[model samples]
Target chain A: MLKVLKYSFYDLSRSRWTYAYLLFFLLLTFGLLNFSHDLSKTIISLMNVVLILTPLIGTLFGALYYYNSKEFIDLLLALPLPRRSIFLGKYLGLSLSLSASFVIGILAPMLLFGILSTGLVLNLVILMSTGVLLTFIFTAIAFLVSIRFEHPIRGFGAAIFIWLFLAVIYDGILLLILIWFEHYPLDHFALLMTLFNPVDLSRVLIMLQLDISALMGYTGAVFRKFLGTSLGMSIAYATLLTWIIVPVFAFLWLARRKDF
Target chain B: MIVRDLYKSYRKHQVLKGVSLGLDPGRITAVLGPNGSGKTTLIKCMLGMVIGQQGEISANGKNIGHDYLYRKDIGYLPQIARFPENLKVRELVSMVKDLRNQPANYEELVSRFGLGPFMQKPLRNLSGGTRQKVNILLAFMFDSRYYILDEPTAGLDPLSLQRFKEMLLNEKQKGKAVLMTTHMVHLAEEMADEVVFLLEGKVYFHGGVQELKDTYDGMNLEAAIANILSLQEHA
Candidate 1:
């Protein structure tokens, strides 16, 4: 398993795109955090970027990577290698890479801020963990999209459109609904929606810790009430872990059953 | 190696219709046919690359698809192979070795295929024939029990062809099953222990090359193939 992962990492490390993404996002994260004095404001500034763009870029890049490497995969498939190990190797390598980038881009700046103000260190750790989940959730979605679509462009377009709908359009429409139904507290409805989208849940949880989550709506309150408890936070992380493993496993099954 | 009544279709169009054949270990069995006559599909089915709708394909006493625990003992050279542009010869060999979970003697493969001087050069710089040679080396690397090659010598010089034939003979000597599909009937005539002539989606004739010549009013395989096609039309 370690060898497989090591090989996967070696393969990706050779790719110029991987290094470029890491460096580009690291610079971008630093720029965003330095946008303001108050960490919450700096965070909201970056949130606009992270919530909308991180998953979109991650999904598109990951999907494109898969599509472009079909010949390599065929060579591998012709060998005695098991399909499950291949999937795990790729998932672990990609997840580890994106998490490392997230740490550099988002977590590092926040961690430095948390150090100056000691109480928020745990809050910052929770927030970064949420980013890890968010990255994996999107990576899985992208993997499925890449396999399902015959054309790489089609897969990339579908991923971008999904990101647009989920991150931008869905939130916009939901806010409109919330404002109109001010008398009716849709706390449960928001929780269900957040659970469905790890990205949304991540955003809400981070904002709740910063106590500047008014725009995050009922979802923010639910995460604060539930995930504020240490056990609830652990359960939330566990659920995110499931989101990572399930789709990848499904992809393995699909690839195994597929007539290559 | 045995192939039991195999059936396959692509959506509404049937490609292989209840085809069955056997290949003896230590001998090359050439599958000869026109395009879209299920020659490629049959090979693909045996590799479990294409799903057979009915029946089973067994090599070394195990079914091809689900019971292919024996793939560790199989080598496949696909019709067309593409390599990464920037990868050197060593990188290419390394990639396959990692996938196979076996250590390959790079010197043996490189020297055998005349890839030593070209080792440092990227795959993009190599000729099409060199690329085909790379694919062949990868296929013959571990020397498993079964070899299924499609258009095995499409791009090769006389020397390379001789080397390839020698490799095929070596596999046969080791009692490894060799099934090949090729347009070069001359090579087929030279090497085939038995000839399976297919037309449309079914086998029109299955016998030795000499049998094909003697039974039909033809001198060699091309005429024999023409005779089979005409017979299929008459039938």
Candidate 2:
């Protein structure tokens, strides 16, 4: 498995798109820092971009990587390696590479501006960890979708729809539900809904840390009132970890029964 | 290797039904069939690439059911020579060697196939024949007990094809089991000690090459196969 991971990492490192993704972050961070001297405002801005873009890239890249490496996978299937190793190795390799890009891209510019001395360092850490967690979660979902659907376009379509559902549409539906049930005491309901979508949970998490009560919305407030700040943050992080783990195990199971 | 009572299907279409055969060492057995006749499915079943609905595929008297370690003793060349496009020939070779953790006689095979020039070239940049050469090189690199090749002669120039045939013969001389599928009847006639003809997911014929030729028309293997299909058509 480690050997597979090493080679997969090597292969992805050489791809031009990996560098392009890294460079995009580098430029975005630098541009955001240059435009705004306030570090808190910059972290919030980066958070918005990170929440949306990381899942998108993770979905597209995960599906595309599976479709592209299919032939190579056939080669691997004929070897002595187990299916678990081939698939889990690929998932970890992809997540690590994308996480590395996000981390390096975001950290380099912040370090250049000397963020270590500021109290905003903790906020930056939360933002970066959420980005990494989101990358792992969505990449795992993409792998599960791709492995299930043999057609590349179908796989890609399903994967993107999942990201869309989790990152955007789910929240929209939750909003409609909240408005419809506004008269009732819906605190627990809203908090449970937030836990269902990693994207929203991450947004609430970062907003709570930044002490931006306005953007935290009703669910984030419920999160704070019921669980307090530290406990709420811990629960959110644990749920995000669950998000990453469930899909990975699901895909590995599917890979074993797969025909290819 | 022995395959007994093999059955496979894709959705509503059954590809292999009650197909069975035995492959012997020290000889080359050719799996010949028309398109969509489940020839590839049978080979894939043995390699455990495609799972069979109901069957038993055993290598060295042990059932190869969800067990991958047995594959180390088998070398396989898939029908398509597609690979990770970004990987250079050398890297791909080494990657396979690393994954299997087996010593490979790759240098000799690379030189024999004249692939030395393309060692540093990415797989996407290589010509179809060059890719096929790489496929063959990988299949024959390790000293495995069995060889399963699908369309092994595709896109090969005459010299390279001759070299590949020589390699197969050498492997056979070392008492390795070889199961290959091909459309080229002449190649099958010249190389296969026994031929297994598949039609509509069944082994219609399994016997010595000369016996197959003699049973149909006392002519070449191609005409013999043509006669069998025509007879099935009339029936």
Candidate 3:
């Protein structure tokens, strides 16, 4: 499994898109920091971008890699290795590489700007951790989508659809439900709903950490009130961890039963 | 190796239905069938790449169910030579060797197939015949007891094809069980000690080359298979 992970990481690290992704973050972080000259505001801006962009890139890259490496994967299947190791190795390799790019891209610019000396360092840590979590969550979901659908176009479409649903549509539907039930005591309901979507949970968690009530919105306020600061952060992280694990198990289950 | 009452289906389409056969060391068995006749499926089932719903497959008197270590004893050459395009031939070979953790002496096989010139070239840059040679080298590098080659002669030049046949015969002499699928009747007639003819997901005929020829009253193995198919169509 470690050998498989090493090779996969090596393979993905050399891909042009990985470098492009890293460069995009580097430019984004440097540009935002240079203009604003405020670490907190830059983190907020970066958080919004990270929450949306990470999932999109993760889903697209994961599905593309799975489909493209399919023939090679078939060859690997013929070898004397367990099926679970092959898939889990691939998942970890992809997640780690993407997380590395995100970490390096964001950290280089921030360190140059000396944000580490400020009180905002903890906030930056939360933001980076959330970014990494989003990458793993979406990549695992994309693996599940790719293995479930044999056709590349269908798999690609499904992955994008999932990202859109979680990153965009799910929030919209939750907002509609909140508006419809405005009269009821809905704080607990809202917090529970936020836990279901990793994107919303991450947004709320970071907003609470930043303690910016105006930007917290209703879901974030509910999260803060229901669980407080430290407890809310821990629970949100746990939810994100669950999000990563469930889809990975689903991917392995589907891969084991799938016909090569 | 023995297979008994193996059955497999994709959706509503059945590929293998109650197929059974045995493969022995020091002999080669050619799995012959028309298109979509479950030839590849059988090979995959034996390799445990595809799971058959109802069957028992045992290698050397041990059940293959829920076990993967037995695959180390089998060398498989897929029908298509698909590889990581970015990896050079040498790197891919070493990667597989590392994955299997087996000591392999591929230097002679590499030179025998004249693959030395293309060793540093990425797999995607090589021609089809060259890639097939790489596939053959990968399969033969490990000194395994069993081999499953699917369309091993595809895209090979006459010289390489001759070399490939000699290599298989050499392996046979060293007591390896080889199960291959091919459309080349001449290769089968020249090499196979037994023939398993599949039609509609079942074994329609299983015996030696001359026995198949005598039973069908045909001049050669090719004519015999053709006659069997035509007779089935007419019947």
Q: Using Cα atoms with residue i matched to residue i, what is each candidate's TM-score against the true structure?
A: 0.91, 0.97, 0.98
Candidate 3 error regions (>4 Å): A217-221
Model 1, position B12, has a per-residue lDDT of: 93
- Candidates 1 and 2 compared by TM-score, better number: 2
Sort by lDDT, top down from the best: 2, 3, 1
Poorest 10 consecutive residues by lDDT, candidate 2 chain B: B211-220
Q: Candidate 1 chain A: worst 10 consecutive residues by lDDT?
A: A115-124
lDDT of 2 at B183: 98
Q: Which regions of candidate 1 fall more than 4 Å away from where they truly are?
A: A1-4, A32-44, A106-119, A179-182, A214-223, B230-235
Model 1 agreement with the true structure over B46-116: per-residue lDDT tens digits: 77767888988887676666543566877889888777667887787777776677656556767777978
- Per-model DockQ: 0.53, 0.80, 0.82
Q: What are the per-residue Cα lDDT tens digits for candidate 2 across A1-260?
A: 99889988888999898999999999999999999977888999998999999999999999999988887788889999889999888888999999999999999999999899899999999999999999999999999999999899999999999999998899899889988999998879988888889998888888777888566577556777754656766788899999999999999988888776
DockQ of 3: 0.82
Show the colliding residue pairs in model 2.
none
Q: Is the docking of candidate 3 incorrect, acceptable, medium or high quality?
A: high
lDDT for each residue of candidate 3 in A1-260, tens digit (9 for 90 to 100): 89889989999999998899999999999999999999889999999999999999999999998998887688789999889989998889999999999999999999999997899998999899999999999999999999999899999999999999999999899889988999998878888888899998888777777888556567556666765657766777888999999999999998888788
Which is the leading candidate under DockQ? 3
Model 1 TM-score relative to the real fold = 0.91
Model 2, docking class: high
Tell me which residue pairs clash in candidate 1: none
